[model samples]
Target: MNSESAILFTQCLQNDFTSLLDKYDPLPNSLHIGYAEANRLLGEMVEDGPVFSLMDWAYEKDPKQLKLIHIRDWHDPKSKSQEDHLLQFGEHCLMDTKGAEFVFQSWIEENPNRAEIVNASGLNDFVDTNLESILKPYKGKSIRVGITGVWTEAKVTFLCYDLKTRYPEFEIAVCSALTASSSLSMHFIALDQLKQILGVNVFSSIGAFTEFLTGDQPNLKKRISTNARIASDKLNLDPKYPITDLDKQILLYLFRDCKEVECKTLDGGFSGNVVLKTKSIDHLGHLQVPCVVKIGNRDLIAKERTSFERIQEVLGNNAPSIVDFCELGDRGAIKYRYAAMLDGNVKTFQKLYGTMLDGSGLDRVIDTVFGEQLGRLFEAASTEKLNLLEYYDFQHKYAKSVRNRVETILGSPQNESTIEIFPGHIVQNPCLFYETDLLDLKEYNAISHNTSYVHGDLNGANIIIDAQDNVWMIDFFHTHRGHIIRDLLKLENDILYIFCKIETESEWNDAIVLTDFLHNQEDLGIPLSFDPPREITNEKLKKAYRVHRKTQIVLS
Candidate 1:
């Protein structure tokens, strides 16, 4: 690596801590220190999700720009720190064992020439290792050195202090989110000391560290435009969504002086709004905050703005605060700066379904979601009525997509005349419904219900849950008059099809029957019963249904 290049020296990402995170066996204090963190340290490396893996991201961005150095705790039989360490932290990281190996040792194995591996038995990485020599090349060259790992109080502290004292010329910084400790108190105290006494820079995230490394004077306009182009493909983005050059300029003026601005698309696409979650330093406060920008056509933005205002007025903190809105002739944007997000994130309702079900306050959870907040939110929005036929226009539009997907999975006849989904069941020609004859019955016309100013499209994907269990809903473009039970129906869909795990065809069938029976009473306004068909025996669906059924009954 050159003098101008940065070095990412990750420490103690060993199986001893990372793997023990999901086990029933007891762990040592050394491992517990990092495990007790609110956000698990180094978890991005192991987790499979939309998370940005710092190492992998760097590798993908440009492997040669950032050099890698790893520190692993290896305690051999004749190790130097064995006498003192044995009694203190107990047996761990024994040499030649998997516990002593780096959790991502394959990284070193794959890039043997680019990656450096240093073994240490003590808290300080420099204590009996060649980390100093490995870093000697970058000394006094104005290169940024980032340190991230476990046991932030001890191991992370010792390294930061020693690295600065030895080579004060090299800028040393720690990515706080990447580093963790088993003891929350000690970890924070150590970070405070590291910054105050040692003059070490503490970055809240990798984006900030990357910003410092690049030394960009930062044009917020350029960052937004650049990232917009990087994420230009419309696959995940809202269809036909465009952040026009004028829109980019507006975003620049909107998020003025924001530094380290990193932009990426979120998971869902609904309401003709393409959402981008971006992390940036607040110009006024100079603190990292993640803001979401929703870009859509002008008509959708205008409607959403009005809907957001109404929901915020009625629900108060239950709704996310709208940062600003930009009107760009045919297209516009809604930027939301969430105030409560310390780390600028909350788990999606889909991600935390298990947490909500397994929570201690079942009554509070049900009441808060169904009775108190969202129930009131549904009341506050609008009141429009449409019979099933009119609603079919929207439903049928969605069914076309589902039909195409099913055809892709199970090839149909060339004419699509008779598509058999099961042994005796078929989605005949046009409407793909098992009961295709029901369309001519004219019974759905008699069943009419007021689609109150409800979140027209409600789903677990757009619902947000924070650490405090407070709910936040997004994607307000569809926040107009809709079905009275639209929100509840969406929640049920998540509990059954989205979150519940049904392995066998029988289980899925049972889930379908259960959901259909329960949801069939939406127009009748009838009280629900918890009983299921005697033949139904899917324990996963049954368990999830029990939670949904109780909430549904109470809300209904």
Candidate 2:
């Protein structure tokens, strides 16, 4: 292997061993190995060979000096087989002092070069404390120390007390020794005592410890930062919008405007209503205020708040729209903005299979909206058409540059395939399953045709209907040049999920009819001949529903 590859492998092994030692206890007469599989594999490699054959081979050749021989709990049965025979012979010989001395001499004579001959009873003393000390600097950093010995109640109490007092910040974990015919009652009692003494908050599972040390823990600070970024990105608004001077100015103007209005306070005086009589349109949050703000002028919907319009011109249209921000008398404060339709109306699917929408009419409306978007996309792609080879070169160049960011947001690519499309398909039959065939289409387009700008998140929630019943889109932060089928697959998947929840055969039939109309939209330009229709089977739907139910249970 190349040096780079070898170094990577060594790092992985080090991480694995370091992780194991952190969570488990290495006790006397008990095995201390990184993983059970490694120990088992090693034993199998040297089962019929000379003593320490595998160890000698690995140590003699490897430059990292990874010469440690570890016996794990699972291999104790095999290790005990040899130790038991020796003990039986020694016990018999011990009946006579001269015989016992002879047995010992013969045993030492056979293995003169051996570092130590330890039995189950004496294994604790054989523990290499110096080896543990070598790992001390790594403590609370990445490596977890596992100390296993024949544990007593008193020993457990003292150990927990000493460790908590000595290393209060360090993540200390413990696991009981698993040996032949071992009873864990004492271990359980010791664990309970440790928890009571050390405080239960510090206690965590091995997996939790690993995640915490790796910086994967969902701390409040990390969560808030992540949420802020996600919200800004989803809205296609500037990241600094909420904290910008423009936003502050808009808030101050809104507060001033409200002060001029005849405000009405509701019961308990917690929330009040304001009626601002102004010729200028009130732009509140992202929505045109006339819709959400009752008693506002309907004709003034196009008007913008004075301060907001000035700031919008300066900061550009991408800044988040502010509504009202004011400090109430004696009360803390209040801020209101246009609540996203998705935030207020979008219901999370309780079951993977459930009637998501009431009827086929909804599906048709969705199909039409997406079809129009696809038409615009095709026009854009036509304007940028190039030769097949050049297109492929450009597609790959672009995708490769942004591949890391894409993977971070949408998850890693599962597989890549290439599609062979005829030239006629570009203008005459451009429709294809975009979401499911994105990677394939990208590769094919690079080798065959030009690409188009596609909305990456084309699911139903991104499609919104206003109070006026006009359909609008919200999230388009992931728009990129790709095939049209990506949008279709997203739409189909959404509809499929909704249809799968139909309770009756008639409902299923109607769903299929609606899906067929969507599948055959001329504006969409999808191929008529494609995958065969399958029954919307309920068994899979029930299973999905059950899983979703379980997830809700856990989340709640």
Candidate 3:
């Protein structure tokens, strides 16, 4: 060959043939040696020829060598495309006279009886016809079955029916790209029935069917068992129905037993429904019982609707020792067996202490009565102090955030000139505390001085010392931070009113001694002067007093 053609051939041998041989395993013995010799010969030929005359000389020597030239040109990356790769190679192989003759000779030597050696180089031009030729062999017996988009019940049913009607002989297998939404179990069930109807079988993958048709079941039972175990494990861990009925029932019972009870009904009597009456049996025993029964929907509302058994377990002898509680019916109605205290016989410290009265002796007496029990309750509550602090912080942050959100709703940049006010604005405004100056009142000052832990609402009804001198401090729900003098002020206020009406020297002396004792107590933080006009009136006083007593205790 000429130098140019020889150079091209030598390059092909170096780049393509070297890599091509590595790709194939157990290279043909004769062919491998022949190719290696051809490569060496081509390299020598290129060195001897003049580059200008090499192409013409090569074409004259062997026209069959044109394939090497064409392959070199076609492989250039810049000219390569699907069209160029197939059409160019195909058309050149079929039309090239010398190349076709060489291929025909090789074919004849291999199979002498074969008359037809079709040149499929024109296959690119007649894609449809070429496809027809390949499929023509199987056309009459080939099956045409429908495939489903989603493996739902309806889709699977339709696919089965269509398969049976259209391709009854060949077995049909539904194909699915297993997904969370696809039901493989349902698909398999439908396919199994279709298999029987068509007298064929079902399979998931091509390998499975090929093995099945060849009578080689690839341990499908093992696969099915493994898959079934995985599915069952997944279903077991699902939280859709995690809790049992008994669990829910117990939770509901506990919630009802723990929630605070509020009075919903009142008896038509002088004593209000929410009031409690205290009776003392000398210094030995004291009993405080609800004055009026509060019931709703046939259920009695007490501090809690705890069972008599639970009450006995907790309080032992302290829980209204003489009284008997009976369940009235199957539906939770209850009745208490006890006598109501006589109005005159029961002495509420409120009557003796007076409104805004100071009674240090009474404070000592009441503290003596419930001090130990209160201390225990406080200790028990302290265990959850971290939780309490977290809740307090959350509440404080929430209040500030909500206030900002409400302000945004009430006034925006667009409506700044025409802002409208609502009735709730006065009460809910964040600036109310700063503007009112109520916290600076002298009454608050006296209250703050007299008690660091004041009986926040030291009203008459809250205190009751029976004939036996056993003190009972009731209605502690409104307890708050203030001076012990405030409790004394409240007590003195009540005693003064009684004194003004009856002129009792004993009551006056009691009030004076109590007030002085509260003032002298260094730890009590009592104020020097009694701040009169304590903002609370007889009409609104009860509500105000209740609010003051329930002062939320915030610990820093």
Q: For each candidate, what TM-score against the reference?
A: 0.46, 0.25, 0.24
lDDT for model 2: 0.31
How would you encode candidate 2's per-residue C-alpha lDDT over 225-324 as one tens digit per residue? 3222122222212232222333223223333322222122111211222221111222232323321211111112112221222222222222323332
lDDT of 1 at 443: 47
Ten residues in sequence with the least summed lDDT for candidate 3: 4-13
lDDT of each: 0.61, 0.31, 0.30
User: Which is superior by TM-score, 2 or 3?
Assistant: 2
Candidate 1: the clashing residue pairs are 32-182, 33-181, 33-182, 33-183, 34-181, 34-182, 381-453, 382-453, 451-482
Residue 447 of model 1, lDDT score: 56
Please list the residue runs of candidate 2 whose C-alpha ends up more than 4 Å from where it truly belongs after superposition. 1-359, 383-445, 495-556
Model 1 weakest lDDT span, ten residues long: 43-52
Worst 10 residues of 2 by lDDT: 4-13
| Maximum-TM-score candidate | 1
| Sequence-dependent TM-score of model 1 | 0.46
Candidate whose lDDT is highest: 1
lDDT (tens digit, per residue) of candidate 3 on 106-133: 3235544422122222212222223234
